[model samples]
Target: MARAFQLAGLLRLRQIEKDHAASDLAAANAFRRDAGERQARAIAALHAVPVEATDASTLFAMAAARASSRSMLADLAALADQADAEVAEAQTAFGEAKARAVGLEKLEARHNASVLAGELSAEQAAIDEIATGAWVREREGNEA
Candidate 1:
């Protein structure tokens, strides 16, 4: 029988940690995409605001609209920046997690290979012993 891997539990924990990090990275990327889309919409709205006005009231309303659009754009830009930072941090975390998991995975592979080799060697030894016994029985029968 093949021996079980000694670090199987630790390997499982590393894999779980890596999976969680991947989820966090995905969420961070989604938030960044959302922030970018909002920023783009704000920019488009700011550009769409009318500059031309026929009267004082219309001019005042236009100014207010442009001001509001600009303020929204600024806020959205800040949000986008924050989202970018979050994505960067998440990517770093994911990379570290992956590295840890990969190391353990490699170790597990080596352990499995060693166990297989041992089993194969034992099987071959048993076959050799059986072959030797058969040869001895045939020779003793011929001598009789």
Candidate 2:
């Protein structure tokens, strides 16, 4: 009975680990997508700043602003690359966790089957003991 409790506790722990892994995968995917969106928005804003042609000084200022925007977009692209790496790591962890969950399920099934077989054997032995005493006929008709 104590062993059974221990086994059950271990199973619960594995299940919790499996759940955490799944969550980590989701978070990583979300972060990757968010980073891409941020980079796209940065580009759009840079493009939206239109250049005016009335004055040479204003035109040069606009050009400088565009250059700055390009630099920022490049930075965002680097961030997206970092996010991709995180997503890949999370995917690996998710695969490992999924495998573990499946393996644990199989192990639990095997343990249950073994326990049932043991109980069945004990019951069968008890039945055999009872039948033998009654069916033997007490020394073929009692003499002592």
Candidate 3:
């Protein structure tokens, strides 16, 4: 009989952790994409603003609008930066989780291979014993 893997339970836990880390990384990437889209929209809106001035008041208003748009752009840029940081952190976490799971998986594979080799060795030994017994019986009959 093949012996069970001693760290099966731990391996399972590691797999679960890896799955969770992957999920978190996906979510972080999605958030980063959304932030990037928002920033793009903000830039487009800023460019779309009309700059034509008909009077002093109109010019002042346009200037104020430009200032507000610049502030909004700055804010969006900050948000995108924060999202990028989150993505980096998530990637690191996923990498660590995957490394742990891979290590355990390799150990499990080695253990299984060892068990199979042992079972095969035992089976071969049994076959050899049977062959030896049959040869001894035939020799004894011939002698008798």
Candidate 4:
């Protein structure tokens, strides 16, 4: 009988961990994209604000709007940076998980190969014994 892989359970756990890490990385990437889009919209709105003001009050309001846009853009930029960091962390975790799984996978492959070889050898030995017996029986008949 072929021996089962000893680390199959551990390998399955490692694969699960890798999958979770990949999911986290995807979410981080999505957050970064969202932050970038928000920053772009804020910049566009800032530019759309009318520069020409007929009265001092209008000019002050425009200035205030521009300031608010800049502040929002800055916050978004910071969020994007945080997202980038998270993505990097997630990528590292995924790589580590994959590496851990790979070792077990290779071991399982080797174990399977060894079992197959043993089975093939046993079959060949049986065939050789049957051929030897037939040859001996024929020789006895010829001598008789």
Which candidate comes out best when scored by lDDT? 3
Q: What lDDT would each prediction earn against the true structure? A: 0.92, 0.82, 0.95, 0.88
lDDT, candidate 1, equals 0.92
lDDT of 1 by residue, 1-144 (tens): 678898999999999999999999999999999999988887776778667899999988988887887788889889999999999999999999999999999999999999999999999999999999999999999999
Question: For this target, which candidate reaches the highest TM-score against the unseen true structure?
Answer: 1
Against the true structure, what is each candidate's TM-score? 0.93, 0.71, 0.90, 0.91
Q: Model 3: which residue pairs collide?
A: none
lDDT of 4 by residue, 30-99 (tens): 9888888888887887778678999999988988987887788888889889988988998898899889
- How does model 2 score by TM-score? 0.71
Off by over 4 Å in 2: 1-6, 116-144
For candidate 3, lDDT tens digit of each residue in 76-135? 899999999999999999999999999999999999999999999999999999999999
User: Ten residues in a row with the worst lDDT in model 2?
Assistant: 1-10
Clash counts for all predictions: 0, 0, 0, 0
User: Which 10 consecutive residues of model 4 have the lowest summed lDDT?
Assistant: 42-51
Candidate 2 CA-lDDT value: 0.82
lDDT by residue (tens digit), candidate 2, 1-144 = 312633666677778888898899899889889999998888778778775668988888988887888788888888899889988998898888778777778888888888888888889999999889876777555743
Report the Cα lDDT for residue 62, model 4: 82
Q: After superposition, how far is residue 41 of candidate 4 from its true place, in Å?
A: 2.4
- lDDT of model 1 at residue 110? 97
List RMSD in Å for every model shown.
Answer: 1.3, 4.3, 1.6, 1.5
